[model samples]
Each structure stands twice: as structure tokens, then as C-alpha cells.
Target: RDRIKTSINISGVLFHFVDTAGIRETNDAIEKIGIERSKQEISNADIVLQILDVTSLNDEDHKKLDDLLHTIKKEDVPVIRVFNKSDLLDSSQHSISIVSRETVISTSAVTGAGLQELKNALIKLSGVTDNYSVYSARERHLNLLKAASLHLNQASDFIKSNNPQLELFAEELRESSDNLGEIIGKTTSDDLLGKIFSGFCIGK
Candidate 1:
């Protein structure tokens, strides 16, 4: 399939981009493949960009729009609805009702209109705030958390028993504290530290 190529790079993270063929009414194999691939991509994506044609978001495209929303919502991924080709709409004469309370940006891809606003909207939707400090969290930390959670559950069960073992509960509490400490680098292993620092840029 000779489809258009699209790529996106965020800071230093590279992501694969998939561009699907435009929706068509025909029952051709190519169109079917395109639809299937598009669905797959939407399901796997961390975020869904539901692009709407600003000039055609009426009854004609309502069913398709509803279907797209339904498909994306199945995976519980956050969606940023884009009203593209907004320049074609007469803002002074006509008004479109956006169902969502969140700001829906009007974009004209051809003229770079609203691109910055779109980017900002996407960044905000991603839930990464500027005030947050970046830190590397490894699988080890997740494992420790899981283990601690399990121990805590066990401790709770023991406390509910008629003959509770106080020493065992105390040991479990200590283990949970140790696990939490590792997450904040208070009790991290040398190997973990080496792996984390090795992945960092040389200048850092």
C-alpha cells in the first residue's frame, strides 16, 4: 500500500506514525485494510486524535464521528478532538456547538493555523505538568511496590485473625517501608544506580 508517511518526535522520544487512507464508501480491499489498520492504531495509541472536518461536521458525518468516538472510547485512551479546516467556516456567521466542555481548537492544517494551540492542548491532555520533576522509575520499583502491597494485604489479614502475630505484622510493615524507600533512591542498589546513570546523556 502506497500510503503517506508521517513521523513524530517528542523531545527525545521517537514514535511510529500511521497514516490511514481517507474514509470512502466503496467496498474495496484497500479501504477495508485501511479501516482495520486505523482501528488497530487507535486501540493501541496512548492518546487518540479525533480529527473532524470543520466544514462537514453535520448530520452527514455524524454517524461516522459517533462510530469513531465509540471505537476510541473502548480502549479508555484520552482523546483530543480537532476541528480541522476551520478557516473554511465563517466564524462571524456560523457557530458550532462543541459537546465537550474542554476547549476544542479550530485548526487549518494548510496555513499552520492553531497548530501551537493544538500542541499545547495535546501537552496538557498528556498530564505532564511543567512543575513536575523528572525521575527514572524502573521495573524494580514496580516489583517492589507489588510485593509491598501484597505483604500489606497479608498483614491486614493477620490483624483480622483472633491470634494475630504482632512480630510478623511489624516485619511486613518494615519491608513495605524499605520498598518505598527504594523508590525515592533512599535504598537503591548500586546496579540500579549504574543502569539509570548510564542511560543519561554524557553532559548531564
Candidate 2:
């Protein structure tokens, strides 16, 4: 009951994958925590892959899948239903009835069948092109951007006020600059400090 993260580059676009714990009834505290994290990851995902056992799907599974589909739809994330262990099924059982609008793929880990189809489907849905460049980011980057935005907003408010505190305004600007600098590895503090000192006219 844990998450295993890895990345793959397909068609020049990098995709981050987080394989989470399988959802099931559990009374164990650690397992419950893992299940909650899985739900959170699903909500935050750009695209989701729901794995199902091809050999054991039943009416109860279908009902649970329907509920999961409804929840995922609310997040507006596209999902791919992967029926794994296809090798266990007979050739006549390869075909499955359509359950939803989401793309469905049957794959066999043993014989490595349908893996290519899955990759092609991912490439298509991701809108990757020959000219595409891979760029990957994480949650920390998003949080930094949000912090920079807030500092900038505060600086803007200071500028629009009647009795604008120029010093406070400058401090907000510096704070915003520092936040952005964390992302790009450069800061304007030295330049800004020089400008502030030049304005002081200490010799006069």
C-alpha cells in the first residue's frame, strides 16, 4: 500500500506516472492512509489509468467502476481502462463489452500483448507531436508560482493606495522577486539594493 512513481518519454513528451495502492476495503490504519492518498492522486492527475483484472471482473466490480467513473468525471480527467492479465483469458474472451466512453485496452503482462496499443493511445490522447519538447514539473513548482503571485498582488495593492508606502511597496516587490528567484536560481536583490542605496544620497 504505497505509491511508486516513474516517468516515461513517449513521442518526445514525458509522462509522469504514479502507481498507487489498489482501492479496497481495509481496516488497517496504514492501508487506509494509502487509500486516501490514492484518491487524492487520482483527483490531481492529468490522465488516469484504471487497472482491472480481466479474469475476475463481476457485477460488483462494474458497480464500483461506475461510481469511480462518476467521481473521476467531476475532476474532468480522462481515464484509460486497462484490463490486465489478458493471457489468462481465452482467445474467444479477448473482446469485452464497452462500459464507458473512456478508452479500453486489454494487455497481457506475460506475453506483452496490447502494450503497443496502450502506448499509441497515450500518445494520441496527450496530443504529442514530432516537434514536442518534454517539460516536467511537480507540485512544489506550482506552490512557488502561487506564492510569487500573492506577493505581486500585495505590491499592486500598495501601488493603488492613496498614501502609498513606497518602502513597503518595494519590500513586497523584493519578496516577490525572491520567490521567483527560487524557481530560476537568480535573484534581483543585489541590483535592487544598489538602487535603494543610490536613492539615499547619504553624502548630501
- Which candidate leads in TM-score? 2
What TM-score against the true fold does each predicted structure earn? 0.53, 0.60
For candidate 2, lDDT tens digit of each residue in 71-104? 7664366778899999998889999886677889
Encode model 1's per-residue lDDT on 36-70: one tens digit a residue: 66666666766666677887776545456456757
Question: Candidate 2's C-alpha lDDT?
Answer: 0.77
Task: Evaluate all candidate structures by whole-model CA lDDT and list the values in order.
Answer: 0.63, 0.77
| Model 2, runs deviating above 4 Å | 69-75, 129-204
Q: Which regions in candidate 1 have their CA more than 4 angstroms from the true location?
A: 1-5, 10-16, 22-25, 59-65, 68-75, 101-103, 133-204
How far out, in Å, is residue 134 in model 1?
Answer: 7.4
TM-score of 1: 0.53
